[model samples]
Target: MITKPQFKSNDYKNGLYLVATPIGNLKDISFRSLEVLAKSDYILCEDTRVSKNLLEKYQIKSKLISNHKFNEKKNTLQIIEYLKSGKLISLISDAGTPSISDPGLVLVNECIRNNLNIFSIPGPSAVTTAVAASGFSDKFLFYGFLPEKKNQIEDEIKKLSNFNHCLVFFSSSKKLNKLIPAFKKFFTGRKIVFCRELSKLYEEYIRKNIDELELFNNELKGELTIVISEKKEEKASQKLSESDINLIKRMINKLTTKEITDLICTNKNIPKKVVYNFCLKLKNEI
Candidate 1:
């Protein structure tokens, strides 16, 4: 059966509304998101200057409140009071969904503590956009931004390397260039995609193997969404046979343990660790 979708006017409730704005293109916003913003008594945003462009484009006249990381905590109490007063308030980031690597969580939590109503106006997301286009595994982990310190960044990458699912990260071009070395060192044998200026006119997707990635000589502008493909699973090691054991026993005394392990692994499709362990066991028994 064929059916036509019907549009209905929005009847907003007085509470906090987490609205999602376009990441790049102004027209990428949903109609429902606009309706919610239009009906909102006040819109809390990370940056009023950035949100202004979007509002002005849609001819939306909703008042905006500046709420960023620095001031979000201080603004939470006042905002909660507004929600308690039965005022319809909306929260939006400079781009993408609110509270996603942006301001809005503190206010949302305050609203929850106050038992206030909250609504979600989902729309665009750089994470999903990059992952979808990267041709990587859909299962992903979005680590918003890498730490500033080099050691912290390495530690973070080391932890993330243990996961088998695709990994997504947000970084500026300069920072991304600095991160390429770390990515190559930790994420070897994996594929990577760099999504630049996503959804914008100069949008670009650079795909490369981790080993082939090199630093950009020219400084690229705008934020980058990096998606690394899942770790490649290793082939199972074959069990050592009686003939293989005898060969290792014969070579254990004549050749060094490392040489024997290397020779056995190179001759057969076996894991180096497995061969190394057997050689170490025989040497220990001697």
Candidate 2:
């Protein structure tokens, strides 16, 4: 809750500043972020060239150092030594906030362990920016990036579908085509918002049902954030009653243990593990 006393660049000094840059539109940056960058002794960036473009645009002159994932571990010590000399330092990612699905966590953690002061100059974040304009409840869950494996993705989406709030995640344009179908399978009738190139001139929020979104042609492009509305409320998952078990047995009679387990799980809308373990106990009794 510390407040900057003034908007002057020289006002900031001698500590680690975690500055938030624009996710898309460069103008989305805050005054404080600019001041911190301008005043810092040097800036640690995911890419020095990318940070240089932003600095040149703003007419701010500061030393630049590359601190991406590959070099972050080794560079952290050097940055800390600079800070130990009472030099003001700032960290920025290519886009959005640092350490949020981006590079910055290691150096920040090191700074924390070294007992150095770290301050945040808030600006744009694709997750919150998309969520704010999503027309969905604020209680939504944010999964920074979708799982890469198809089975893992499906399971994760299925778990999120059971929740009662919106879900947000980042995906490449390549994965978007594959993701929509899975969303339809799990969430069915829910609405989705595909926020592309947010805050930039080409920014667009394409709202459609997951089923309908699946019909969109391939070659969709841009950095994408997919927001899916929660499914209609259903009864919570709990142990099934005897009546429920009887209904499942009717559908799976004389079926193998695997078949019985699957039918019982679908009937009770519970996790397969729970149903499988229960079916194992029933087999032991017989």
Candidate 3:
């Protein structure tokens, strides 16, 4: 059995502590997380009631302050003053790591610029957990959240489809119906994994072809992180013939095959191996 970290007495010395909390499962909370919350002079959280539940569960009695997106600007200054006065402050979100798809980046950046010490007690992160279990490439782009508008989402997906890296983004179950259709339109023929309720008892990873993701989206629940595989480039670009390759080579004969590969690999469109193979096949035939 794994032992949780004990909330150390002196961990929150000064400055800000960004604590990672469990998304759903209380057991997901880390040892240092409990420690930071216990020792901090004040806790700045997204939702007081939500944070209260976690704190009360652990029996932590620190003061709680609301610091969400709408009021973060004002609260940040207040937090800075507290830090300046040598008070220990902790920033936590309702679930998962702070400032990810949630809120916290602005304050964290401000704290860093002002030379305040910032410590992160890492624990459960939906982004990392989803990516780790995705079975996709290790390399990925964490998009955090998708655009709210349909056209904007299509444009973004089209732009990202050019890359070979797996892309991850957070979405809500309410938006899953619309989002899955847009994904199918812009990113067809790619593999996608929809991770829901990560680390919870009902945690699930539904892997499907982008074309088929719609059916699975019907019964989806809880918060979601969608991981879409980069579009298949060679299949998209395979129409280019030996003649096209020759034309490109002739246009830039002075460039090396590696250089040519780099140029054609624009946006991770084609697999490097495919590009290199095309260069070799064309070079020998020419």
Candidate 4:
């Protein structure tokens, strides 16, 4: 039997409301989010111009205040003052939930410092949206955006490669294309999903094995939410044989640890860590 939800009247409170807006399609907004925005004394927007389109669509007339990354800290005092004065101010990003790779944290922290009331009016989120559609393990980690520097990005990806659960990331099309090589190198054997223009008319989900992924010849438009599938289980590598230990004992005095590791791992299915640790155990025994 299907049961309908019993809707209740919202008792709008006076405080800062961290509202989640639609990631793409403006129609994806919730009734509760709309009601809160409609009754808000003011709306704090990451970009008033971008937010205006959504607000106007729903006929919400609340005064808009610019509250992006550059000006959030400066606007903190005044916003806190408004909250203290019992004003119902709502903070929203241009899209998605505020503070999820978006502005709103500064003002939220200010509200907390002043012991002011704060509420979250949840709605659309690109992270969960992409992960849910990925068909990967539900256990996941959301790494908001990758770093810009090549070395930093490489280091980050290398570290993230160790996790066994699904991983999500946000990136512009250009950045994502540039990252294809790095993704291929570190995330080998994993499945990947590229979610572009989510919920919009041109929405797309490009799924591929990491090894099979290739850079697009033509540039793709809009932001991308990427989901990498969880690591696949592999058969445990066999323990070193008596001959293997004797071979390492012979080379232990002649080759460096790294050289030994590289040489031994060249043809073996064993992990470098296992070989490296074994090499170290032989060294310490000397």
Candidate 5:
């Protein structure tokens, strides 16, 4: 906890200043972000407790307010009034860019509706960080985090079924057990990469295809950025291999749907329900 003041007070415009904080490593924060945060009249953050650590780090003496999921809508009106009164308000999330998958959108929109000046001091973004690491650096689509309900998740995946771009999703470790299965069902034949705990010391990247979805257990922990590539590129040989597919095809004739589903799930480490669905799809095709 090196607490020497790293920033000096500077004059920022009277509006909402969106400051990007570090995703994991505190040092990943930018100088401009520090300057904006230091100069603001007050700081609105997703979690005052989380932002407290950041503020304490730089000795950022600005006042802190809680503006997260629950209170954002209610607080937006007050924030709008604050901006109208010509005060520089800084908005930051627990980590990464504000409004990407966190609170700040409501406040930003409220500020916009009132024609208040909005400044974005961009820095760390898990979306771009994961995309940059993902090999499919072509056209990309960030779908934020998946909805919690099962039906909503299914509906969202169905809507994006024909999407050809690299689909990106921010999923929590808990929801991933269901979310990964959704990806398996909808994005078959696509290459998937799990960027876990990105930029953190325990950072991990697990890449696999929708078909070869075995062996990667849902026992994974930490924040996840799941990227599914559109088309199978020839850059690397298919790890699952054509021979594996041929064997599965051969088994399709001998094994019952349930038996085949059980075998694949056991072999691949995928969830039973997902493997069952995959087998049903495979059975329908042949």
Candidate 6:
């Protein structure tokens, strides 16, 4: 039998802690996560009632503050003030990691603006869990949860049409009827893995050709994580685009290679390594 791990009291810092709670199983919560919860001064939860179930299981009694979608904007100022005052604040979603598809983005942004330290406890995530289970290409663009409507979903797919990467996104069970067919029409011939209720008792995976996905007529439950493999013909780009080349040429004489790399990577659509190599080639000539 595997003995339960014990945790030492970490010198809790005065910063924002982003804790990742379990998506389904409570037992998956790590020793560090429990320690953070036990030690944090204020815990911002997406749902107090739901989070209480997890906290109670571990005997953690940290002060819980409501921070869901409905009230996040209203609470941002107060949360930032708490951080500024050197209070130990923890942000947690009801399940899984916070701020991926959850409501911690506002608080995080505010904390960033005020120059407060933010630490990630780094535990469970639906994106990584599903991707690991699917045996698909590791290179993926996780779009979090896509818009509900058909038109918006199509528009989003159209925007990402140029990039040939394994695509990851979340959707509700109701949208499976629309989502499967939309993906078929927009991204045909690709293989997709629809993981339903990951890390739970009823977890199911439906890996089928995108063209054949419409035939899945069974009622699906829990949240869905969809991963669409890249088309074989559309290889990942190695060379920079003409526009990126022009940008690099324009900035070559004006900035350091590292500075140019940072600017291009931050503002342009080019990859960092690609831009860095371009800078190196320019640096050699200089």
TM-score, each model?
0.83, 0.76, 0.78, 0.81, 0.76, 0.77
Error of 6 at 209 (Å): 0.8
- For 220-284, candidate 5 gives per-residue lDDT tens digits of 88778888887543342224346545666778889987887666656454556655565567789
* Tens-digit lDDT string for candidate 3 (45-78): 9999989988887888999999999999888888
Model 1: per-residue Cα lDDT over 1-286, one tens digit each? 3122233545777889899899999889988898888888899988889999988887788899999999999999888888888899999998898898888888888888889999998899999999999998989999999998888888999999999999999998878776888898899999999899888999999999999889889988988889999998887566887888899998888998889888888757788788888988887888
Give stretches of model 1 more than 4 Å off: 1-10, 237-286
Winner on lDDT between 5 and 6 is 6
Scanning candidate 2 in windows of ten residues, the lowest lDDT window is: 1-10
- lDDT of all predictions: 0.88, 0.82, 0.81, 0.89, 0.81, 0.84
The deviation in Å at residue 196 for candidate 5 is 1.3
The top-ranked prediction according to TM-score is 1
What digit string (tens of lDDT, one per residue) describes model 2 on residues 1-286? 4343355645765799999998877778888788888888889999887788788878788899888999989999999999999999999999998988888899889999999989988888899888889887888888888888889989988888778888989988887777776888888878889999888888899988777765557666866988877666655576877876776556444777788777666645677776667667666766
Best by lDDT: 4
Candidate 4, residues 1-286, lDDT tens digits: the string is 3222233446787888999999999879988898888888999998889999998887788999998889888999888888888899999998899988999877777778889999999999999999889999999999989999888999999999999999999999888877888999999999999999999998899999999999989888878999999999786586876777788989999999999889887877778888789999999999
lDDT of 6: 0.84
Residue 152 displacement (Å), model 6: 1.4
Tens-digit lDDT string for candidate 6 (42-62): 999988999999888877878
Stretches off by above 4 angstroms in model 5 are 1-11, 215-218, 232-286
Candidate 3 TM-score, C-alpha based? 0.78
Residue pairs of candidate 1 with colliding backbone atoms = none
Error of 4 at 133 (Å): 0.9
